[model samples]
Target: MKKAFFIVSVLFYVNSYSQSESKKAKILEMISLTGVDKIGVQMMDNIMNSFRNRDNSIPDDFWIEVKKEVNSEELINLYVPIYDKYYTEEDLENLVKFYKSPTGKKVTSIMPQMMNESMEIGKKWGQELAQKVIQKLENRK
Candidate 1:
C-alpha cells in the first residue's frame, strides 16, 4: 500500500511538472509572437545607451557584454512568472493574435515615444501643482 501511494505521488509530481513546463513554453511563445520581449530588449538598449551617453569612461565592449548578459531570453525568463500570474494560455493566445494585427503593431512601435512624451507632460503638470501648493502655503503663512 505504501509503495502504491509513493508511485501515485511520483506520477502526480511528474504530471504537474510537465504541465508547468508546457504552460511556460506557451507563454514564452506568446511573448515572442507579440514582440513583447523585443520591447524589453529595446528598453534595455535604451538604458545602456543612456549610460554610454552620460559617461565616456565605459568601453564599447562593456556595452556589448552587458547586452549579451541581459539578452531577451534572460528578460523573458524573469517575466515568465509575472505573465503566468496575469495571463492564462487562452489569454496569451488572444494577446498574440491581437499584437499581430496592424493596430497592435503600431501601438508596440509607438509605445516608447508615447511614454517619453507622457513623462514630460506629467513632469510639467507636477511642477505646476507644486507651485500652486507653494503659493497656498505662503498665503496661509
Candidate 2:
C-alpha cells in the first residue's frame, strides 16, 4: 500500500509540473499576441533616449552596447507571473484565441495610438482642473 501511495504521489507531481509548464507556454503566447513584448522593448528604447538626452557625453558605442544588453524576454517573463496570478489557464487560452482573431489584431495595433491620445487629453484635463482649483483658492483669499 505504501509503495502504491508513493507511485501515486510521484504521478501527481509529474502531472502538476507538466500543467504548470503548459500554462507558462500559453502565457508566453498570449503576451506575444498582445504585442506587449514589443512594447517592453519600445519602453526600454524611450528610457535610453532619455538617458542619452540628459548626458550627451556618453559615447554612441556605450549606448549601442547598453541597448544590446536590454532583453525583452526578461520583461516578458516578469509579466508571466502577474498574468498567471490574475488569469486561469482557461482564461489564458481564451485570450490567446481572441488575440489571434482579426478584431484582436486590430485592437493590438491601435492600442498604442489610442493610449497616446488619451494621455494627451488627460494631461489637458488635469491642467484645467489645476487652474480651477487655483482660481477657487484665490477667490477664498
Local accuracy of candidate 1 as per-residue lDDT tens digits, 1-141: 999999999999999999889789888887776677888877898999999999999999998988878757877899899999998777877777887889878887787789899999999999999999999999999
Write model 2 residue lDDT over 8-105, tens digit each, in one string. 99999999999899999999999889998899989998999999999999999999999899888999999999998999999999999999999999
All candidates: TM-score: 0.73, 0.94
Instruction: List ranges where model 1 is wrong by over 4 Å.
Output: 1-11
Looking at model 2, report the run of 10 residues with the lowest lDDT sum: 30-39
> Which portions of model 2 miss their true places by more than 4 Å?
none
Q: Against the unseen true structure, what C-alpha lDDT does each candidate score?
A: 0.86, 0.94
Model 2 earns a TM-score of 0.94
